[model samples]
Target: MKKNLLIIPSIIFTFVLLTFFYLLVIERNPSELPSNLLNKDIPIFEAENLIKNKKFISTNEFGNEIILVNFFATWCKPCRDEHSYIKQFNNNGIRVIGINYKDDPKKTIQWLEKLGNPYSDIPIDKHGRIAIDWGVYGIPETFLVNSKGIIKFRHVGPMSKKVFKKINLLIKEIK
Candidate 1:
């Protein structure tokens, strides 16, 4: 009976080790973390517009057409790196709402002016409340919301060429 107990525990330990090894070996995108908000309606909130001197209300901005909601900050290097890709999305006729996350308004304006703004609306999230509502994991997160205002896909971190292509394809598929 003593040997049987030891053998059973050993077997279970080995099985768990193998399962972990399999998971580590399998191909997976670490940046593609699952989001609780995926496939759900965007969280309702309103904020002052950074650029247009108007209120950026959640109810008014999302339902009519597909939109990209990008949470970015001036201090984040990755956000700067992905700015070109964000601009490309806008240039391709994708309406983008750039949420300025916990950043200084003056610096954000200067950053956009230097980078060439591509966002249709710039909402100020001074204390990161909007980002919290959206369940943003970090700066430079992007969400693809459908015409009906439901979030379809989310990408975290800097946008790379591969990611940009994947998003373009997703947009096509969504349409």
Candidate 2:
């Protein structure tokens, strides 16, 4: 009876060791956080347009297509780091709407000009209220919202090549 009990404990320990090894060997980015608003309707708000000189209304903008909304700022290095990937979406005929989070309009305009403007509509979130509504805690956050204005996927940090490919795949699946 004691031998059987010892065998059972040994088996359990071996299983736990294998589980830890499996987890350690898996490919995953630790920095990415899942969005709280997945499959939920986008947060509604009206903000000034940085370029259009008009009220940028959420209801008026969304619900027509599979759009990628980027919450970014000129000051954030990650935002700058991810600019090319963001532009790639535009290059592939995706409409990217940018929410300029708590950034100066002049700096934003200049930055876009230098980086090559990829955004279709640039809305000024002079205060980060829009970001808060979208559950954004960091700059360079990207959200993919479907035609019905439901947020499908969100990436929290700088866009990597791997991440870009993943987003493209997700976009196709949702569409």
lDDT of 2: 0.91
For candidate 1, the lDDT comes to 0.93
Native-structure RMSD, model 2: 1.6
**TM-score for every candidate vs. truth?**
0.88, 0.91
How does each model score on lDDT? 0.93, 0.91
Which digits, one per residue and each the tens of the lDDT, describe model 1 over residues 108-162? 9999999999999999999998999999878899999999999999989999999
Tens-place lDDT digits, model 2, residues 46-94: 9888888688899998999999999989999999999999999999999
Among all candidates shown, the one with the greatest lDDT: 1
Candidate 2: segments with Cα more than 4 A from true spot: none
Pick by TM-score: which candidate is best? Answer: 2
* lDDT: worst 10-residue window of model 1: 27-36
Off by over 4 Å in 1: 1-18, 29-32
